[model samples]
Target: MAYAIRPFRKHDAAALADLTLAAIRSLGAERYSDEQVAAWASRHGTADRFVVRAATGDAIFVASDADDRPVAYALVGMRGKEVGHVDMLYCHPDHARKGLADELLAQVEHHCRAHKVTRLFTEASELARGPFERAGYTVTHRRDFAIPHEGREVAIHNYAMEKPLT
Candidate 1:
């Protein structure tokens, strides 16, 4: 399916949050307890919060359909001197593997380059490592831990990946 890539808008916050939660659940729930997942969702999935975050100059890009409904997104920002972070990147489950993620990443890379960012980093779940690696991010470390979920703790591991964009 064809999708339009554009700057994320304040009105897109709710949809963005929903998309993020859905993508995380679809890809990482096995490693997260229900409570932990719920807690994280509650904290980060609010539309208003996303609006505020995006309004502050954080570069957010969204992929939408003809109707302007968002189907995928990527959030990127500079964290420090020469360091850019991929805060998040998600595509609707139905839209997976269609190159939306790549498009989003490209946007982020462009943003980083514009800012003269020399390093780009992101934490990738097991399912995401392959794609990030293919995109030229090298795995720097892997860490395992338990996250609080619905009623218990769940085990999960994440790979810290980085790419030199300079």
Candidate 2:
């Protein structure tokens, strides 16, 4: 079934939180340890955080499944005045590999084009790198980030990718 893409609503916060963790935990295994995925998902802080950030941006898009539940989401926002960043993109595990990410990314690119953004970038997770690369994004570098998990700091790795839109 085709997904329904829309701007994020306040009611989506709780569902987005759940989707985020499910997506990461199930799909991140190829590139990260279970502990790393856990740490990354926990960094979301709270559902309120997602709601606030989604509202702050002009291009927070969520894709709903046939049941009208959010299955995937993407955020494309200005880093300055000319650059767009893909801050987050995730597909619920149940819907993985169904092209939800590509659809969400297409929405992000639409926002960038409409806003005159010359370039778009993201720190992409392992599972996300493939789609970005296929869509013409290049990896500028690989980086490791530390996040707090349980009582200690855990490291997660990602690729810094960029695509020139202009």
Candidate 3:
């Protein structure tokens, strides 16, 4: 299906949050245990989080369905005007593998270029590593961390990837 890539809107926050949870629960299960996936998904449980991130100067793009609802999104946090970190990239499971993410990333790269950003990076989950690599990002290292879940720390890992925007 063809999806439209556009700048994020305030009303899309809740849908984006839902998309994040669904994507993580479904796709993350392939690479992470149930507990780890749950832990990761919890961090995105609030729509206000996206609002705060955008208010803090992050650039966010959304891929919308025909009805103009968000099915995917990409958020980039700029660092000192020369670097950007892809803080989040999520697509609803129903829309997976449809090139929506690639389109959003391309839009992000275009935004970064206009702002003179020379580097873009992300800590990509296993499910996202291949897509990021295919998007021309190189894996710099593996990031291992733990998140609090049900009173314990759940272990998780992801790849640190970067691409030169120059």
Which window of ten consecutive residues has the lowest lDDT sum in model 1? 34-43
lDDT of 3 at 132: 89
lDDT of 2 by residue, 35-97 (tens): 897888777636786776666664678999877888889877665542588888988888889
RMSD of each: 2.6, 1.9, 1.5
**Alpha-carbon runs more than 4 Å astray in model 3:** 79-83
Q: Which model, 2 or 3, shows the larger lDDT?
A: 3
Q: Local error of candidate 2 at 133, Å?
A: 0.9
lDDT of 2 at 129: 96
Query: Of the candidates numbered 1 and 3, which has the greater TM-score value?
Result: 3
TM-score of 1: 0.85
Off by over 4 Å in 2: 79-83
| Clash count, one per candidate | 7, 0, 0
For candidate 3, the 10 contiguous residues with the lowest summed lDDT are 78-87
Worst 10 residues of 2 by lDDT: 74-83
- Residue-level lDDT of model 3, residues 38-131, one tens digit each, is 9998887689988887877888999999988899999999655425899899999999988887888888889999988889999999988877
